[model samples]
Target chain A: MFLFFLSSGMFLGWSLGANDASNVFGTAVGSRMLRFRTAAILCCVFVILGSVISGAGATHTLGKLGAVNAVAGAFVVAFSAAMSVYLMTLARYPVSTSQAIVGAIIGWNLFSGSPTDSNALSKIIITWIVCPILSGIIAVISYKVVSVFILKRKIHMFRLDEMTRYGLVLMGAFGAFALGANNIANVVGVFLPVSPFGYIELFGDFCVSPAQQLFFLGSLAISVGVITYSKRVMDTVGSGIFKLSPVMALVAVWAHSVVLFLFASQRLEQLLLDLGLPTLPLVPVSSSQAIVGAVVGMGLLKGRHNIRWRTVGGIAGSWVTTPIFACLISFICLFILQNVFQQTVYLP
Target chain B: MAFISIFKNRTGIESEIDSFLNLASESGLIFMQGIDAYLLNNLDSFSEHLSHIVETEKEADTLRRSIEDLLYRKTLIPESRGDVLELIERMDALLGRFKGVMFRIEIERPNINSQFHTGLKSLSNCVIEAVESATLSLRSYFKDISQASDHIHKVAFWETEADKASTSLQKAIFNNNELGLDLKMQLRDLVRSIDKIADHAEDLADTLAIYVIKRSL
Candidate 1:
């Protein structure tokens, strides 16, 4: 039973890698700043680093979302979420693994009679709404600031040019690192609860003990996903929406990272919410959404005419529909899998 | 008496020709470096420099063609002959783009609406670094190519930076409304072309580095 959950987590991690890694470096590749090979290699390295170093908080949130004691339930949720993301990716739609997983967990909770944590759900929903919008706004402002102040001066053209070039490289590198740090949990957080990391394991008799091991496996799976399946989606996302200039790409990425960090910061989210402001919890919202919002925001700052409404509409439609569709499919799958497998598959 | 005087004058003139050749060779390096600086700083003023460089490069091309003809007549060049010819051709093409990019900069100059100045500058600097490295490598007279490799890496670093700047610049451009839509599109295209110059330079540097490394190995 434990093995089933662990395997399901690995599949979820693979699907996450396939979908999310594209978000991290797609712009760079799309803009031809980095080659596909280079981006893939970088994604692999930084994602693993992100998973190992900064993946803990999200893992805990996922583990506590619902009861994981019923191994079959955990497996069903994991499998459903993975399949949803996979099918979406196959259809060339940029769906959010974070959203799918949360929805799946919610579906399971509904059937299990576990009271839904409205607070958690609200926070998650708020993040989903705000992250992209905020990221877009920040990208616009940052671009305006940098262009107006620093790039205009003509003091030693060669020296200034050199400085600007170096600065951009550093910025991209930082963005990549932040992406890894903030997103690792979304890929592998589910397995943290069932695994035995504490001195006395929570699921003592369960086969996979230590949540950290699950994270490690999850990270490995993500790496594999990044290497094998990320390119197709990366190519699609990188080139689909709009043609990006190097600076715009940087701004978009920077904005996405900043928003991810903001949501990922529990302390910050609480402070904002405490101030009577609508705040999003550190739920992993779609990086794709955050980037598109940032890109569009930057465009709006340019003017409404510059915004590609058609592309934006398409993306919005996907965001609105993907999770619900995934949930329904997973719910149906769960029913079917149970009926077919009968006693072989235990449903809690 | 007239024949003897003409003969003597011709001999004196022949002796002075070497000094002129030597002067031309020394001044050629200065001219190339000046062209690099002009392209890097005053990209908006590209046409003027491009014409001059194009004329000079044509002269070099003629000289190279003549040399090739002579080498072919003399018998096939030795073992390194193929490489030498290829190198010379590449060097000429590199100079040609310097001319072409300058012309392009001029053509795109009117659209320079201040938004892309930073990205343009960074890209120009990357080219300058690459050219400077190539110049240094050629003139060092020593066989050490590490110096050249170090400089090429710097160029690559700058190209990466240029890419970042362009992304931001484009974003800003997209946000700006004062510029007409046509002008904006033109500016975007121009910036892309300029960025490609750095990319080309980086390619050159990478190739040179590989050659140097392989030779060392």
Candidate 2:
């Protein structure tokens, strides 16, 4: 029964991997620079590291988004988010897992009569839009800088090719680590209220917290998804609307990882506070959108001939609909999971 | 010694350029064979040699196009791309000039005085030397750029000799009273056509020298 309940979070994890994981190495693999096997191996290793070490920062902010309050409710909320993501994906929408999870949590707050924090909800929604634009801008700058600095050098084409491939592998590893640290909240934050695992001592000295244990499990599901299902998404993203040159692909993914890290880094938030500066709001941003925006940014810089407008519109349309549909789905699924099945989904 | 990468065989530009270079060399060889077939008046061999040169020229063209597509798709060497492209185009012209001279000899069947035969053969040798030195300079440019200057000088010397020999051959054709006035002009045009082969090689050597200097800096 514990395994059965945990499967919903795993399903959400799988959805995250199937969609978000592609953003990390999609272009590298798609452009056939680094082989897919090398990409997957690097992604798995760094994702596990990021989840184990830095995954705690985003969970607190996600808790502020709205706590699920009960294990059964957590399962239903996660299931609903997973369902929304799965459905949107089948409809060929580039939906955000971050958005769906937040919407489901909001659905929980509404269903249980808890006061919804409109401020927190709005912050997340705004980030969903802002993160992509910021990445795109950064990409435009990176393209100009790299072109002026590196491409202008009288370098051999093969030397440049070799360097770019190595750069992608390194950048891809960083992107995976950032994705795990920032987005692990969506996978296991709901389960935090009813976490089952106790602290386990490892290496005889270090204590692995219950939260880390849950995150580890969640990351495992994400790895499974990466290993099994994300290949097609990688191929699509790699070969899609924007034809990326090596440098453009590198700039885009690196910019995305930087943005995700900036938003999700608790230490950076504290540093900003200490410096009396405005802290970047800690939120789970969409990896898919950040990468898409970066690609679009490169396309615009290359003169808009390559940007597939239909693809851009389809993804933008999904951003608005995904959350609304997830809210409805979670509201309905939680109600059924609670009343029809006679399950104690909520404290009330 | 050139800096080599293992990844180029898969789709590396260095390997592709190397193959292009190899094809360029083969076209030069077949150009000689076509001349020989024409000189011997072996029509059957001449047709085969003509067809072979045509086929090699087409393959070289196809290889050049493939390399250009890859370069545009990624533009790995944006700085030297124009120079590299110009070099390939110039090298390709050697075969083009060879084919043109062969076609003239086969179709016009000019009744050349035997004295001009030695001049044509010597001019052909000089054309071959110019092409060979130009190709060597190209290889040395990619391999050990500093040594490229010596090969460039050799290409320049051979090109000068070719220009001088072809001019003398034209003068000889015109001086012969037995040949028709129209025939003298046609043979002069033929010598000029062959002269263009060395001119293209000289052009490539000059471009390569400048390209290597830019790269070395």
TM-scores of the models, in the order given: 0.57, 0.71
Candidate 1 docks at the CAPRI level of incorrect
**TM-score of candidate 1 against the unseen true structure:** 0.57
Q: After superposition, how far is residue B152 of candidate 2 from its true place, in Å?
A: 17
lDDT per residue (tens digit) for residues B1-217 in model 1: 5334434433433233223223224333433454445545655344444556667677767756754553344222122234445544565566666666556655555456554555556655555555555444432212233355666667677678767766766777778889888877876776666566557656666666655553331
Candidate 1 Cα deviation (angstroms), residue B163: 40
lDDT of each: 0.61, 0.78
lDDT of 1 by residue, A314-337 (tens): 767777766676567556656666
- Which candidate number maximizes TM-score? 2
On DockQ, the candidate that comes out on top is 2
Model 2 residue runs over 4 Å out of place are: A56-61, A192-213, A265-279, B1-177, B180-217
**Clashes per model (N, Cα, C within 3 A):** 16, 0
Q: How high is the lDDT of residue B78 in model 2?
A: 47
What lDDT does candidate 2 reach at residue A13?
84
lDDT of 2 by residue, A1-348 (tens): 777888898998887777777799987876667667878888888888888789987654445777667888888888888888877666545568878877887888888887778898888878988998998998899878876665356445456666777788888988888778877877886677577789899899999999899889888888887887777777656767576766777887887877787777889999999999998888777888888888888889877977888877877888887788878988898889888988877776
Task: Give Cα distance to truth, residue A321, candidate 2, Å.
Answer: 1.5
